[model samples]
Target: MSSITLYSLDGCPFCEKVHDALDDADIAYETEWVEPLHSDRNEVKRVSGQRAVPVLVNENSGVMMAESDKIVQYVEQSLA
Candidate 1:
């Protein structure tokens, strides 16, 4: 099973960038849509310490990070 999990939100440009990067690299990953409020927000905060989009968690490598540019670069370097 793939160990990549992306925490993102719809209509977010940052998240979209990460998505494109993943697709460009043909890396299979699971997505967790972090909604704006309540439960979803809590989940993101719990994992990343901030309620933000474009969070990438690579369990296989023990990498859990937040930031679109970094996430894209990491994905490209690790899988592309």
Candidate 2:
């Protein structure tokens, strides 16, 4: 597994933004597709303490966060 893991849901624009950033940066990461319903996103909640898509977990850096813009910026500044 890659050092980074992105938690995302299908059709989530925010998730797409992060995905694009990672792809553009040529960062090697894994995607964990989350459940469509927030209530069903137990793994996401467990990791990030919330049921939100576009969560990023960087095992190498020990950074676990949520939010697309921040994640993109992080990728640019750190991962990229």
Candidate 3:
């Protein structure tokens, strides 16, 4: 089993969308909540080069990306 990391923020609609997609696809993922000063949002930004919510990090495949559509597509493809 590979590991998937999702960087999200509470109450973010985009992040919620991604969460639903993951559940629908039956994909298991670890999540990191990005808050103003509560967590390491900068680390995610540093790695992805963009401080965007719902960043999906596929550690197994060494892929990191933002955007809900792309994230869902990547997840589907990776699982397949």
Candidate 3: which stretches are off by over 4 Å?
36-40
After the best TM-score superposition of candidate 1, give how far the Cα of residue 80 lies from its true spot, in angstroms: 1.3
What is the TM-score ranking, best to worst? 2, 1, 3
lDDT of 1 by residue, 1-80 (tens): 67899998988999999999999999999998878664559887887898978899888889999899889889888879
Q: Residue 32's C-alpha lDDT in candidate 1?
A: 88
| lDDT, candidates in the order shown | 0.87, 0.94, 0.82
TM-score of each: 0.90, 0.98, 0.83
Q: List the residue pairs that clash in candidate 3.
A: none
Clashing pairs in 1: none
What is candidate 2's lDDT per residue for 1-80, written digit by digit as tens? 79999999999999999999999999999999999999999999999999988899999889998999999999999887
What local lDDT does model 1 show for residue 56?
92
The regions of model 2 sitting more than 4 angstroms off are none
Report the CA-based lDDT of candidate 1 relative to the real structure. 0.87
Cα-based lDDT at residue 54, candidate 3: 82
Listed per candidate, the RMSD to the true structure in angstroms reads: 1.6, 0.5, 2.6
